[model samples]
Target: MDSPHGAAVKAEDFGLKGPRGWAFRGIGLDAAPGSLIAVEGPSGSGRTCLLLALTGRMKPTEGHAEIGRHRLPKKMAAVRRIAALGPVPGVNDLDQSLTVAEQLREGALLQRHYGAPIRSLFRSRAERRATAAARIDAALDAAGLDLATLPKGERTTVRDLERLEAVRLSVAIALLGSPQLLALDDLDIKLSDTERTEVWALLRSIAARGITVLAVCSEAPADAVVLRTGPKEDGAGAGRDADAKAEAEPAAKAEAEPAVEKDSGAKKDAETGPATATATENDADDTGNDGNDDNDDDDTKGADDALAEAGRA
Candidate 1:
């Protein structure tokens, strides 16, 4: 279960920009604590950037937000502790070489060292180890992942795990500390309709139990608090101005975009952790537990919230 302190999220006049233009900028919304918020938009529409800002990984250039009791760009450190990411390409990808158990353990260690109460650092090794084990178990259960059911049990390498299993494991790791808010990107990117339904069910259950969830989808379901986003021009409508602009600067626009590769091809990005899929244009996230600095790339700080990783696994 999430901590009893699950937070409500609110934003006003929030925005972030890049050299190409605004990634996303607008007046934000107010959501009741533990509400399910879906950010829906097409690729390059700034869904990923929006997720980063809401979670406090990226500071907004224009407005502000209240995540729980903390404020953005001010108390973002607190926001970082309460919110975590799941399967955000470039931020939370699985380490394909490691077994499921190993990933869980590593994630637990990372969360404990960076996310838990500072007093935990003073605990005895044995006590910490026991706590970590229990943490993993609870998170796996909460995420609906039963290690024993896997083909090789917990010993299965991420390389061998099925797509759904990979998704579950990614979620399970993010829940290790039972963060009050969970942010999952690319919610409908890879899964089939049935798989997407199952994932939504899982997210709903997580939210119902008091952990707020922010999901990215091509479109929001009727039941969610939807935050629709896309490229800057989307807000302006598909009029002649938008068409003319794109037609006039296709090459420049394409060069400036940080591509999200959905195909099987893989290439490494700069500055973030290993395993990040190369962007045809630029980079923003890395898949794994480590994030990057804002200055490192035009992409938002990848590791600023929940050692995010990106990977098919």
Candidate 2:
């Protein structure tokens, strides 16, 4: 398969907010097509969210980003069609029970079913199978994965493969769709120094093929474009604090409301002591207040006015 030109990625003040707080914010980035963009940050620094947002899998709360001619999040579906995710935990993790061949076939089938043009679905089963097989082979070659080297060759389950091999398989699966932009998370997890170098080299080679590669890692390769998503201390913390304060204000008002009402009611009751007593006595003496109807009405009206004012407070 020939290389496809990748999308140019650009962002300004990009941000994503979650229920707890802003996952990431104040991000600025610019990278040309086919650039190997490294998202360098610690574990909880919102690197994953940034990756998903860039690929249009997750929407941003503020600012904007452009993937090729498609703008996020308005063109999220468009961006999603051109971009693919590789080995993202909780998003596209490889199934441990599936064999290498099974996983590759699954990817090809899913791509055909969802990503392919409507006319492609009309192709004969044999033609479709051949096409899938060819794409799988091309993907395996691009990913530098050799089935012969594995302990069980094509039958090797994901859990049985070594870390690097699993990574390669995941990349190959992602490549089956011929995505112009590929995003990978945790590139250096549980790998030795030599393995990390190999992973970076693999990504660089993919980028060299005119495919944009977005990789998340603790450190970035010197030659690649780097976008660092720092911890919450870098502006996002203030947003979280503001959110907390906003929530707290309503609860504080609710608590203070009852106290104010009680205090006002007590103050009004004390000031209208005689009126309050007379009103209570009139309530107990149901039919006897007709004798001095004018005075009784005056006391009752005064007490009612005082109660209404207290309730308003």
Candidate 3:
């Protein structure tokens, strides 16, 4: 389906090459309204890079990418308005000093402060506070975060919460703007399997509500349309062929041995018995050809007599 913003995202021949000569290339993708796409690859394989490009946070060196109706600009203000990016774990940028409730309230206020006209800024204080509070509460509820359950019930700082709770708070802050597109980076990083499952379920539920969801993960979820990046196609094929060759070598060697042994055994039997019989016949002929049989006997008898005399002496 076409997005209300015209096109949700479009990238053509997008690529990024680092100073170290490592590169990720050959990417072409489109994400539309009500669509959920996932970028999956091993560490350093450019999944995060691609996600950033699609969200207009980073520009591609070679190709063009668009989010909503705007091409990536030197400044991403327009794209940032229509899209919300979730926080990266371990990054100290999610307002760690503020309480969960305060963070959500601040997020909504900031979006309004930046986007609203200056004429509206001078509105009555009571009306503005009521609007901001309602928006913050709605965002927190949608994220399944209840600040009332915290130690000080809306006054608890982020530093006091567990890692999972912090992540949920970050999600709530992102959702406060009610963006048309949600870009989540490393959604499953460091999460337990069950926690990952829960997060995926939440994302799916969000997508079901009609927001386009794009996430970068080490592996793709079952319901996500995965865009994978890694080695070149030829390199992958060569590796598979090499593995197949290695597996076949042992079986080929095993089949060859029996034929060699049979040939050697036949040769040995053919030579041994005949050669021994011929040697015996030659010995008999040599004895028969000693025509001076009596002389031979006399010489043998003399040798025996000499040995007997030596023993007696």
Candidate achieving the largest TM-score: 2
TM-score of each: 0.73, 0.74, 0.66
Q: Write the per-residue lDDT of candidate 2 for residues 90-148, one digit (tens) a residue.
A: 44556698787666655554554345556666878677666666776788898999999
Candidate 3 lDDT tens digits, 207-239: 776778888788898878778877643332223
Please give the distance, in angstroms, between residue 215's alpha carbon in candidate 2 and its true position after superposition.
0.5
lDDT of 1 at 156: 90
Q: Better model by TM-score, 2 or 3?
A: 2
Which window of 10 residues has the lowest lDDT sum in candidate 3? 271-280
Question: What lDDT is obtained when candidate 1 is compared to the true structure?
Answer: 0.63
Question: Which stretches of candidate 2 lie above 4 Å from their native place?
Answer: 234-313
- Candidate of highest lDDT: 2
Clash totals in order: 17, 0, 0
